[model samples]
Target: MLDQVKDAAREIADARRKIAAMGPNFDEEILGATRALYAPLIRKPSAAVKVTADVAYGSDPRQKLDVYQPAGAAEHVLVYIPGGGFVAGDKNLDGVFYVNLGNYFASHGILTIVANYRLAPAHAWPAGAQDVAGAVAWARANAKSFGGDPARIVLFGQSAGSTHAATYLFDPTFHPAGQAGVAAGILMSGPYLFQGELRPNLKAYFGDDPSRYAERSPLTHVGKSRTPLLLSVAEYDPAFLAAPTYELARAVTLRDGKSPSVAYFAGHNHVSTVMSFGTPQDDVGARVREFIASVG
Candidate 1:
């Protein structure tokens, strides 16, 4: 037993060293390695938790979601959106990814919803936000059936997912009847403000028009949003994302006359930050839990 513990520690240390060496770059190799290292460490949801998989929230097949229902009553419902750089991603990537996140949050008594949105090029701009709104509507209507409070739904997204959640939370154009239904929004490493040379993946969704980028950006409309926000950035995130994360925080502070909750995950890269959930090395999971509880 002692040897098994020692082996796990050594393996974790080795993985961290390799990831640290990769620095802040957004590399597929690093993402795959990070997922591989933590997948085994993620615990399966206990028998107390019930999972309803592949439920449709919208008409499109990509608009399906997975629900993680806790043992007893849940104070809040968290809708988690995964990142795929706008063009790709899913609710369950490689099976383990977001399933682990759902299990982790559900175990802590939060009814977790892992959702998939429409991808880019085929469906652009407001499509992602529209899917998010659909998912939120589903949660608000059906949360009580799963032992979750409908009024306390939290919107959470990572990377491109974050951008979609931010758009739904901030932009009045996407809001239903000009009302942001979420209790709070948690945006992790999202590109809130689109500026300068737009990447091909981003352009695929936002289109080739640079002039419309500002108006379409969530940052441009955040000033009018009164909903609470929790912003986070990974320590080893690519340089391009770092600016937008802090810029969004600054913009929110300027608008609200106070700073929102901000978290910096040290020693974590873009992918590892979300992948670390349910692992022993997880540093931000507790913060996320606290944020949800505080908001609730």
Candidate 2:
């Protein structure tokens, strides 16, 4: 046991070094390296948490979700949207990623939903938000059947997924019957405002119409929405993504007359914010659990 403990400590130390060495870049190389670091460390899903995979939320093939059902009754349900740069991402990436995320929350007695939305260039713009609406709709209708409270559903999105969740929460155009339809929202490392030079991925999703960028941005609509929000940015997030977290928080504070709950994860990059879910170095997971508890 002593030897095992030492080995685990050494592994964690190595991971910290690797993550720190990688800096705050948001490229495939960094993302892939981060995944490689965490994959081996993440334990398999607990048997106590039952997973129902590839459940359809909408007609589109991409509009599917996976549910992680806790062993006991759950008071709140979490709808998780993953980030894939608006071009490519899924409910399960390389198998371990979101599965670990779903398991982590469900194990804590929160029924978890990991969802996939249609990608950009093929689907584009409101499609991701629309898919988020569909998934939330599905959760609201079916949550009771899965021992979860429909009225206590929360939206959690990371990166591009966070952008979609913010759009769904803030933009009335995507809301069902002019209703936000969610109790609370959690956004991590999202680009709320689309200012300055557009990235290739953003252009693919929002198109070449620079003039419409403000109208399409969630930050533009944030001042009007009254939904409770928890925003977070990693210490090592890329500038484009990190800047908007503060921007959205400021918008929320101005709207609500108080600062919204916000978190800054030290020593983590954009990808590691989610990748660290089921590992020992999971500060983000603890914060998320606390947020859900407070909201639920």
Best lDDT among the predictions, by candidate number: 2
Candidate 1 structure quality by residue, lDDT tens digits, 225-248 = 988888999888998987899999
Candidate 1 clash pair list: none
| Local distance difference test, each candidate | 0.89, 0.90
Global Cα RMSD, each model:
1.7, 1.4
User: Lowest summed lDDT over 10 consecutive residues: which window, candidate 2?
Assistant: 171-180
Give per-residue lDDT, candidate 2, residue 111.
Answer: 98
